[model samples]
Target: METKARLVAAAREPLWERGYAATSPRAVLDATGAGQGSMYHHFRGKEDLARAAVDLNTDEMRAQVDTDLGGPGPALDRLHRYLRRERDVLRGCRFGGLAQDPEAMASPVLAPRVEEMFRWPVGRLAPVVREAQAACELRPGLDADRLAVAIAAGVQGGYVLARATRDPTVFDSAVDGIVALLDTARTEP
Candidate 1:
């Protein structure tokens, strides 16, 4: 059981680094330091094991966002915390990056997992945006749902910009630009 868990954890980094189509089962085995016999014993094959790793990866991503956004604080402050938290910028978002992959996008099996990864955050973010608006931290008449979508876009799009330019600052600048736009929406006393 522990060995299987270890295998999933090992597979996760490679999947995030290289996406589903590129990473090999042998690489996963090497990462976990487990033998082929053990891999087969633990999983049907690479796809089955990759599913486990992807599931774990997506769950972990959700928990982090839930904690940062759901934690008690001023609503906009929570948004700021989420956007400003240090990330492996050049590596990009594990979930968002997967969504862009040709193979992953084409696969019915993989595509929904990627969609859930985006949907969960945007759904969670809506309430936070509503809270910010209620607190007058955001301007009235703005649609919280749209704002939440924008926020998600900013983060995911930041990853795109960073990866394209091979510069982490591109990601940070995207985040900062979104933050500034939100700031402009702040109500004056």
Candidate 2:
């Protein structure tokens, strides 16, 4: 890999694993076997480099969501596929974990990236929820945007619950519970 790419690749796992506050410049440099000068040459500093890493991770996440949400099915099925997709539940979400970091959350420079990362799922799912409503798979009274936000919130909240309990099944149960509630909205006589 190119030096800049290598640096970013090295930094991503540590940032995800340790969160922004705990991930240090030296650890990132050590991961890439690059020196301080090399990192500085490519990035303004640790936070700048972290921004790039988070951006990279967000791109990957978008691709994964597209795979699940864009799959062939009724809109609800696609949304279910998204909610049921494999995840490292106890590891928590990288963006969510980063947002939890006081250092990242406190900074205007960093918080927006974390915020935007979360906004993607809600935005992407809104149309799918609307389609389901139009098909009467969802009740007509349901607000598409709010339902989309709820779905995204469930996934993120699942991670938090699983992490807190140190139990992956807690994540599964939360997801299954949300899906069950969505099922209740199905329009049928």
Candidate 3:
């Protein structure tokens, strides 16, 4: 890995563990074994470094979601595959965890990037939901966008509930519950 990439990887856990507010530039440097001058040359500062990290995380997330949402299936199946995809259930959502920090939430640069990560998944799922409704796979009253947001929130909520309980089962249950709701049977005459 390049020095910058190494720096980003080293920073990921600390930022996820300590959050942007508690995390320091020096911590990233120490974690990566990069000198201050080198780190600065690669990034403007901590905020710039954080933006890079968020971008990396977001891209990875988008790719994983695409794998689930872009695959062949009914809408409910696609959404189920997405919700039930293997996850570090105990660790929580990377971007969501960061956004919970007061400093990260306040950061103009970091906040938007973190928020965008969540928004991307919701947006991607909305189209799939609309298609499902068009195919009559979903109830007539289903709101595609709202349902997408709710699904996103359920995943976020799963992370929170899991982390709070320090167990993975809570997260799994949350995911299953969301999937079950999405899989609700359509009314057939």
Q: Which candidate number maximizes TM-score? A: 2
Off by more than 4 A, model 3: 185-189
**RMSD list, candidates in order:** 1.5, 1.2, 1.5
Off by over 4 Å in 2: none
Candidate 1: stretches off by over 4 Å: none
Per-residue CA lDDT of model 2 for 78-159, tens digit only, reads: 9899999999999999888898899998877789989998998899999999998888788989988999899999999999
Query: Which pairs of residues clash in candidate 3, taking residues 3 or more apart in a chain or in different chains?
Result: none
The lDDT values for all models are: 0.87, 0.90, 0.86
| Residue-wise C-alpha lDDT for candidate 3, range 122-183, written one tens digit per residue | 89999988887877888868888999999999999999999999998999888888877877
lDDT, candidate 1, at 157: 93
2 or 3, greater by TM-score: 2
lDDT of 1: 0.87
Lowest summed lDDT across 10 adjacent residues in model 1 is found at 96-105
Better of 1 and 2 by TM-score: 2
> Which candidate number has the best lDDT?
2
The collision pairs in model 1 are: none
